[model samples]
Target: MKRSKRLILLPHCVLNQNAVVRDLAREPGSLSGLVRVCLEEGLGMIQLPCPEFTYLGAERPPMDREEYNAVAFRQHCRRLFAPVLEQVTEYLARGYRIVGLVGIAASPSCGLFTTHFRSGEGPGRGVFMEEVLAALEGEGLSLPSLDVPLGYGVDAEETTAFLARFRAFCGGHP
Candidate 1:
């Protein structure tokens, strides 16, 4: 067997909708289109933990970034990402090229490019992503990342557009 030496980091919810908040999942189990595209492209994937789900549990309500923006939660994000960071580091050390991150667009805990707040949506990294990206940079591993709506798996046209951009930006040349 051979290896591609390429992979992307994904939020746990991307692979397990059961980890998402009530009535917010786009698919029954996984984001089928996204997963299918990844599989077709032969890109490896590393599903990162869902900070909110792990901390607040499946029954927890969706929260705004401000509400989740506490020192305690920040610390928790770092704690949860520690092992993931180790895994990322190990992969890099073994010569694997990182394809980057794919996160929920408006999630308070995992949004990469856009986040949610009481007032409305805003541009920023989520608590978990803030920690994860910083940790990766501390190790000199700055990778590309993007965010999509919670309903990313809903429409094919949007999915195609998003994936094209994602691949062009985050794929190739690692």
Candidate 2:
């Protein structure tokens, strides 16, 4: 019997972590190289979250949430992730069984384990990744997500190892 293809979902911030997009109409990134690697490793599917979620409004407000309304803050997050959620749903519908998910390590919007906040600085925490994972879990998707926290530095070897690990998890030969 033929083995079912595996899918991987990753935030687009993985391509460009430091840049923010003020214009929503602009196309976000060309993660072609990364995608190529995935294909080369025998990954059958790849899903990318909407750029807006990772870029459009990534920075935290100048002041703490105490200066912002809870309703507005929640609204901001929902709006930013709206497009991403839509794309994620679409990917899931395409018979893509999520094998792994990758997220930035410390982005207020896309980090998986650490994100900056307004208060005296919260410990390693990324709201975006947490939210996305929760949603995926709600839908019964099982996938391992790795959060690489290097703010602006890309260690090619480490990243390659990370991807290799994901491939191994998916039954791909190391």
Candidate 3:
């Protein structure tokens, strides 16, 4: 069977900034730069579920990891991740090479290396990220994951740095 060269898991906000809560989106009603990069490189991309949006809706108040770490929130994340895990597993079984899983840095529910906590930013994975990692572990699978913040605006320096990091995470160009 034919398989895609690479698979990239992206947070929902990266594709649909308008779905984000409050004024936190960097590119409202448009795709983030990261998504554009993936498309240009022809990588198979998957937009993961947004636990926050699913639970609280688009108009919900912005919150941090501390607030989203509750049992109910965690349960919601788990539920949201189940189908995602299944899809990843199917892709792997089909011999699709998953380059990496990309998340939103400093997000309360989707961050990988940085998370929003206690009204501030901190070093840690977000609630939904935790569940995703746990599901990957349960399946005995491991893949490189990185978090790229989306609210960094369109500054040239910031965009360059983010592209560099993303390229590095993908193991060089494309």
Candidate 4:
């Protein structure tokens, strides 16, 4: 049976074992085997960049606080989101159908629902996900997002599950 080509945008962190924002570069092998696996399973994978923080934007971890700098937070968000926007645009232009975007949950910059940030008193959601979702909506791009928890933590089984869900969504083309 021939499977349709389905596009999935994966966060670089999940794909790269040695990736960190300190250098702003990733190892060449980060996406090596993963890409082949995606193709073998009928996915046209697009590896997207993820931003890392040196210190969680606070003296202490933002997960310990409740809010973050509204202005700086948005700027940081742009850093993470802009590249994804460009990648998605290019994929669609190349006739690739986007099935969904996969990101790490609990990430201040990429969390789908519960990212943490430093509030004046404690920690809270940095609102990065909300902004990304809104931006996509404004641009008329409705892409489903999968928030894979860290418990999966780069497990091969988790990756397989992710690909399966991605393929299912692409099959529906919504």
Q: Who wins the TM-score comparison?
A: 1
- The worst-scoring run of ten residues by lDDT in candidate 2 lies at 60-69
lDDT, candidate 1, 71-164, per-residue tens: 9999999998899888888988999987878888988889988888888789887888988888988888888778876556777778777767
Rate residue 31 of model 1 by lDDT. Answer: 83
The sequence of per-residue lDDT tens digits that candidate 3 reaches over residues 83-150 is 98989899889778788888888888889999998859989999999999998999998889887765
**Which ranges in model 4 have alpha carbons more than 4 Å from their true place?**
1-5, 20-37, 53-69, 117-126, 154-174
> Candidate 1, residue 80: CA error in Å?
0.8
Candidate order by TM-score, decreasing, is 1, 3, 4, 2
| lDDT per residue (tens digit) for residues 80-117 in model 4 | 77767887777778777877876655666566755544
Cα TM-score per model: 0.92, 0.59, 0.91, 0.61
Ranking by lDDT: 1, 3, 4, 2
Worst 10 residues of 4 by lDDT: 57-66
Answer with 1 or 3, whichever has the higher lDDT.
1
Per-candidate clashes, comma-separated = 0, 2, 0, 8
Which regions of candidate 2 are displaced past 4 Å? 1-4, 15-33, 44-73, 79-95, 117-124, 151-153
RMSD (Å) of each candidate, 1 decimal? 2.2, 5.8, 2.0, 6.3
Candidate 1 overall Cα lDDT vs. reference?
A: 0.83
Model 2 TM-score (2 dp):
0.59
Model 3 alpha-carbon miss at residue 154, Å: 4.4
